[model samples]
Target: MNTRKVYLIWFFLFIFIPLIGSAKIDDSHIRSVVQILIYDNYSKEYISSGSGVSIGGTRVLTNYHVVEDIIKQPSRFLAIICLTQNSQSTPDCSYTAHAYYKYGIAGTSAEYQEELDLAVIYVNNKKDTNGTWKSIADLPMSEFSFDSINPALYGYSMTNIQLGDEIQTLGFPDYGNNTITYSNGVVSNFWMDDGDFFKDHDGVLAIGTSAKISHGSSGGAAFDKDGYLLGITSAEILDGNGSFLSGVIIPITTFNWWWEKVLGYEIIDGVGYTTGSISKEMFCKILYKDYDKLHNTCVCPKGYTENSNQECIAGSTPGSDVKIDNSTSLKIDPQLTNRLKGYILLQVQSQGEAWYVNSVDGKRYYMKDGSTAYEMMRKFALGITNSDLAKIPQQGEDKAYLSALSNLKGKILLQVESHGEAWYVHPKTGIRYYMKDGEAAYALMRYHSLGITNADLDKIPEGIL
Candidate 1:
């Protein structure tokens, strides 16, 4: 080769090679990546330290640990991907994701097991179209190869990485408090297997420099000075000096292998390449399924107790009974003071009878022939020559009082007659009650009417008659 030719080749290499390397990544690009938050259903808690990436249009890449259990029992868990941007305010942005794929590990042992730790989750870009999260585009895939020594086995290290390379890793770390904290350090060495740090896989080796990782930073990403992704943050090394110093990362090649298998896609130039439409509904459905399962297995709504049938039933407690003033021409039921303290009035209707009475909170109450409100004073005072006994009114032969009683408490007064229940006047609130014989009628009447059978009524306190 001539000297002139050699000079020209050297110039080209100096300029073009650097440009190609520079094209791989930059500071702005690194900021777009994200950390994932995983929920553990079995423990009913959050797994703060998962790692992930935002692939354009709200789609995210993460480790299977971030969403595996959630997908397995849709009812028990959910996943959220978080992106941090630069703003005067906090840079955090969150997106709910559906687990589209969970790549399985090949073996029980770390060495034999193909690190199938990759997971893909779909985010609804349309729903969150505000660009709150950076979109991923032009991603590289596993099929793409770079020319170098041992590329197949050793994998590509971060470009431009030297013994003293200054690098920054991003992740959500635990501070014992439930929030993410950031840590920074430099590359300690090129490759140092100071024990299982690289060997037995018991812990991470010292390939790069960093402070000890906190609780939630596992699965984060590490970037070189040029902002190109070096590796996925996996673990760290603690030294005998009581100083934690190095972070171990899975080479990018491992990410590529798992990405290809799980996403059914390829990468071009460090960008993930996809070929089909991903549905948002399917993604939400995954979370919804998990939410439903958890909700069902958990406790019932408040103010209710489980019945013999495992169904929720209303709570029961004693209520008051009051008397009416029969001497008054209007025959107004005696207004029971503090009537609202203990019981609610429920109205019910029966085809055979037209009126009935019940008690709550130590008080006997009566409903008019068609009223829903339980007139507390009427039951004790109406047609009663003595305070202990009262005359039961009969509308006609074979047709006794059909109104039912209940004990409920609420401010709103419901009109029971509109639903074909009998009307009765309330002495305390002056509201009218109508009786209907179903649960709706009882609820509408705002009473404790439990659709109690005649047999059940026999169990009431003797004073409740």
Candidate 2:
């Protein structure tokens, strides 16, 4: 080949090759990078701005300072801007959300030796005008190192990485107008032991990347060559003229350590995302009980009760003592309702989203879930009828008080039902037990008022029990 042709080809490759690589990185991850805009609830004005990375589910991990106002006054005066659309262009921000205080944030403090300036803000569930849910893109799950937090393993292990290994970083730098900003930099320092991010104490390790972390880039992620999140970019040390100098990063290993200490779950290899989908069969097993269909094994039987040998016995019948006359008048479609059938009516009136055969009129009663339904039948059964339901703390009212009641379960005359979760008295001791409302049919819960007497046992022939 001629020297002129060779020079031209090299020049084209030099210019276009980097551009292609940068474009590919942005294309794959721009959606997962979120721009967080905070606001004051009372004044209805904009607060400070920063960036966040979705660890998964509805949770966004950002610097604690980013949502500091929220941590101070949650459910009092705080609002969050959620990017519900593709954030590549102008992010399609949805209806302002002050309702998210319920979901809450974790680790919002300047403590942990200022080492933990991290917070995981939870985005609340909201529906748009079309009744569709507002969704945010989740970052790909990245594993954490379980070996140990050290400079040698993280800073200089990979063949492609060295002491001053070049790294490609992306974040929402306000200088880039809050759009996804890309910067090429190198590993500046590894603070696994003798490092900065602290003045005195030999605190936890941190990463110092030379990436251009501009304003609004706090809590953004730093990725490696293969797009694995290495750490989170927190701050940058600037020169007197306010020019960028060195950036301070919190390694993903730091987060993994904190998460293990606090949340008690491991996130490496995508084991602890919490929101990852599971099959319906597995779903029934994990939260409520244990079940594996392959060997046809479960902790309890199909009827959800154990036999003399402690083995699960399937298809057990309801042992309701009484029966109601003309029960057919109270029958309803079993497909739409979860009420147990053929059980005798227990109360005069019933409430919640279930077909109820009223002992008073013998007519079917249907009410929304969570209201006052099973209070009467429970009263008759255990004398825990009225004010006790009012006194027992409802879920989310006082978590601590209910936690205390758990230890007293045996001492108290508590009747634990599946879905109907009112405090029923222990006909003997009369102590209260906080029953978490569940929907296992074998337990005869109050989620849907299955009347005292089973009227339509045949209507709902099949159940998860």
Candidate 3:
């Protein structure tokens, strides 16, 4: 069979038969999972079912294949979410809601379903007391109860999950009568998709786990022991004889690309940071552990103050600061300071303090404090574009940059190709730290501070531009 045809056959085999459960899971996690029921548009008769987990609000994330047929011909098919289980442990038809067509990736090619099998569906209608589907209006929007994964544990930029980490899968499988099932397993392999599109991507696209999932488990949840949603129950790998091999999962990193790049949602640490997405109370609570400590990071949307220097120092009061003047009468010839570019000079005549020579302008800036150090690093950064930066091997990529770093210590490099972000190359470790802002520069200064004589600083003249 062709690859696409074989995948179609595999998708059908993996999506319909009842799925997951042998290990115990929390009740809250069980309640958050739902069964996706497909029905005939005209007859209202149940056709097929798959599993999904609530991400937030009314959105449920699942495999694209589970609803692919309905998406192809919405006029002939309908999809609804079953919120609870009946006496038979199957998805209860009573507590049901119709899914509102929402954002999802259908993929550019059928062959790419192995990497692109994901979708987001929304539930808008709920069954009333009279068994009639009505617009959900029973409770206050704030009172809507739905279990969601903590954003902190969503693990987008996280990489602590190793090859042998334990994992669990939760979904409804056919053998389990379309009821929520949980299974425990270990991550066996981490691999990329067999396509050019994702082969060169940054991280692992899929994970092969011993944790088993079945047909109805297509969109269910795979969680780490700490409740971090590792991925979704996506596919099953079979041996040459069509026997079970290992369950394949669509890793959260795959979801990260679609959720952020495709959907245009601003995600900060895996949580939507847009308006009406996360409340200030919830944001502070999640970040600082106390709503009142919002000032600690100065990241809150409102009520933060800036100093006369326009620096957003945490807990600084307005009108209580004086700005430092960058202007000076000191003069130095370009010829005299040109060779000292990118050098960290020490003033032996003073307190034996060190200063940075701007590689771009060939000027010396004092590293008086963290704030000043940050300002000076930015003012002196050498604009190296990406194509140019790539030529300099910071690591094993190229050794020329390393050779230069040996002589040019305490250099400030600016990636002009990017957002012009500044970075400080440590004099000893040769490591680079992102100078995010004054606060970050302050921390970098303390950690990478070096002492030298004042006589060396006097030899270098400050440049006036």
**TM-score on alpha carbons, each prediction:** 0.37, 0.47, 0.49
lDDT of 2 at 146: 9
Candidate 3 residues lying further than 4 Å off, grouped into runs, are 1-24, 85-90, 94-115, 137-145, 151-158, 193-201, 268-465
TM-score order of candidates, top first: 3, 2, 1
User: Candidate 2 — which residues are off by over 4 angstroms?
Assistant: 1-23, 76-88, 95-114, 130-161, 194-204, 271-465
Better of 1 and 3 by TM-score: 3
Candidate 3's TM-score: 0.49
Instruction: Arrange candidates, best lDDT first.
Output: 3, 2, 1
Residue 349: error of model 3 in Å? 64
**Candidate 1 Cα outliers beyond 4 Å, as residue runs:** 1-31, 40-47, 91-94, 101-116, 125-160, 176-182, 189-206, 239-243, 260-264, 268-465
Better of 1 and 2 by lDDT: 2
Error of 3 at 2 (Å): 26
Which structure among the candidates has the greatest TM-score?
A: 3
Instruction: Give the Å error, residue 365, model 2.
Output: 32
Give residue 430's lDDT in candidate 2 (0 to 100). Answer: 27
